[model samples]
Structures are given as C-alpha cells and as structure tokens.
Target: MTGSGFRERYLDVLASIYLYNEHRGYTSLDRVLDAVRQRCPDDAEFQAEIAKHRADEEKHYRMFRRWFERQGRMPLQVDSGVGHIDRFIQWVFRCSIEELDTSEIVGSEDDFERLCRVIMLTEQRGYAQVEIILKNRLIMSDPVMKRIFQIVHKDEPDHFLPYQRWLERQGRATAKWNERAADWCIHKILMLAKLPALFLDAGRPRLQRWPDEDDAITAH
Candidate 1:
C-alpha cells in the first residue's frame, strides 16, 4: 500500500478501536454506577459525579458513532480483546464484566476499594491516551475525528477524579504499583499486538450495526 493508503487505514482502525472502547466504557459504567448506588446510597454527591461521568462516556461514544455515520461505513468489529477496562477487570477480578458480581464487591470494603483503584487506573490511562492522540498527525488529518478527540481530551481529566476522591476519603492509596505496572503492560500489548494485527488485516469484518442500536431500541 502507498503511504497515504496506509495512513488512511491506520486512522480507520484507530477510530474503530476508539468507538468500540467508548461504547464499552459507558456500558461498563452502568455496573459501576449500580455498585456505587447500592454501596453509597446516601452519598448523593458521589452518585451525581458518577452519573455525569457515565453521561460523558455516552456522549463520546455518540460522537464516534456520528463520525462513522459521516463516513457512511460501519466501524470494524471489535470486542473485549482490545478493551482496556475489560482486560483490567479481568486481570484484577479474574472475571469478565458480565461475570462480575457487583454485590460481592460492594459487600466488602476491600473489594470496593480495589474496584475503585481499577477504575481510576483505567480512566487515567484513557486520559493519557487522548493526550497523545490529540497531538497525533494522523488523527489531526481528519478534522471531524480531531474534534471528537478534542472533546474527549477536555472531559478526560474529570473522568478519574471521582474515584480518586472516593479513595482519598477512605484514606486508601489511589493506585498500587502493581496495578500501574499492569496498566502499562496492557497498553503495550494492545498497541503492539492487537492493533497492528487489525491494521494489517485489510479484509477485517465491519460491525453490522452501531453498538448503541440495542439501547436505542430499548429506549423507544
């Protein structure tokens, strides 16, 4: 492929990946919100913050969906394999998001604390990534994509603050060294292995529908 061809493919794959992750993020936050509501029923402030965070995630997801719509093409099909929070939860809880027992985590202080740490780390990693992408030449080449990422860059910092503040209120460390190490390793593995594989596979299948299609149906 020519250099321009390669760059186009790279942006498509990158945006698809971002779209998938954003969808996964808001959906996963549903579970986290559930846990927070149950565990901190009286903490209205915290619940409101989490609600806003979830809303921001959904907004970002829609922005990427609109970007794909403008291109008149579906995003590439992607699953939890490239999802940062999916891998992080699996690593920490030894279970997939579907298998996670929110009740169990909320029932134990230690478990809830660990969950907060995982979330904080994941959000921090996401913020850091958006920082890099905002400056990326390839991402900047597409004005719409660049604008989507710019919004994400603006909202990214606040995404982790609620969890970090909760941990601080509990007098617990925000993130352990090992968890940070795991986050670094997971990012490397996705960037080095999974992403390159997607970029090289020119015939990769695309999603049949938007990730939020089902939610839209239910909302109606």
Candidate 2:
C-alpha cells in the first residue's frame, strides 16, 4: 500500500475498533447498572452517574457510526477480542463479559470492589489513549473524525471519576498493582498483536448493520 493508502486503512481500522468498544461499553454498563440496582438501590447518585456514563458511551458509538456513514461504507467487523474492557473483564473475572455473573458481584462486596477497580482502570486507559489519538496527525487529518474524538476526550475523565470516588469512599484502593499491570498488558497486546493483525487482514468482513439497530428492533 502507498503511504496515503496505509494512513486511511489505519484510521479506518482504528475507528472501527473504537466503535466496537463503545458499543461494548454501554452494553456492559447495562449489566453494571443491574448490579447497582440490586446491591445499592438507595444510592441514587451513583446510579445516576452510571446512567450518564452509559449514555455517553452510546453517544460516542453513534458518532462513530455517523463517521462511517459519511464515508459511505461500513466499519470493519470487530469482536470482543479487540475490546479493552472485554479483555480486562476476562482477565479479572476469568470469564467473558457475557459470562460475568452480576448477581454474584452484587452479592459480594469484594467482588463489587473488584468490578469498580476494573472499570476505573479501563476508563483511565481509554482517556490516556484518546489523548494520544488526538495528537495523531492521521486522526486529525479528517475533521469529522477529529471532532468525534475531541468529544470523547472531553467525556472520558468523567467516566472513571465516579468509580474511583466510589472506591475511595469505600476505603478501598482505586486500583491494585496487579490490576494496573493487567491493564497495561492488555493495551500492549491490542496495540502490538490485535491491531496489526487486523490491519494486515484485507479479507476482514464489515458489519452489515449498526450495533444499535439490534436495540431498535428489540424496542419494537
């Protein structure tokens, strides 16, 4: 590929991976909300914060969808394997996001604290990555994509704050050394292994529909 071709393809894959993660983010937050409701129903403040976080994730997902729409092409299909939070949950919980036992988490204070730390680490990682992406010339070359990430960059700090505060209020450390190590490892793996693999695989399929379409259908 020429230099221009490589840049475009790299941005495309990068945005697609981000799109997938944003979708995964809100859906996983749905489960977290469930656990919060069952475990701490009286904590309206925390519940509202999580709701806002979920809404932001959905908003980011839609912006990326519109970014793809403007290009007149679907994003490349990516799965949980490319998702940072997905991998973090797997590594910490020893199960996929879908397999996470929210009930078990709600029933155990220790499990809930672990969940909060995991989310805090993931959101912090996201904020850090967005800061880097905003500085990337290829990402900044497209005005619309740059604006989308700018919005993300603004919203990201708020994403982890609530979790961190909750952990602090509980007299627990926001994150442990092991959890930080795991988060760092997950990011390196995605940057080095998964992203490069996706970039090279020109045969990768694109998503036929937006992720939110399923929710739209289910609403009917």
Per-candidate count of clashing residue pairs (backbone under 3 Å): 0, 0
Question: What is the Cα-based lDDT of residue 47 in candidate 1?
Answer: 93
lDDT of 1 by residue, 81-159 (tens): 9999999999999999889998999999999999999989999999998899988998798999999989998998778
TM-score of each: 0.96, 0.97
Give the whole-model CA lDDT for all candidates, comma-separated: 0.91, 0.93
Model 2 accuracy (lDDT, Cα): 0.93
RMSD of 1: 1.3
Superposed model 2: Cα runs more than 4 Å off: 217-220
lDDT of 2 by residue, 1-220 (tens): 9999998899899989999999999988999988988888999999999999999999999999999899899999999889999899999999999899888999999999999999989999999999999999988999999999999999998899999998988899998999999999999999999999999999999998888898789769
Q: Give the TM-score comparing model 1 with the true structure, all chains together.
A: 0.96
lDDT (0-100) at residue 115 of candidate 1? 91
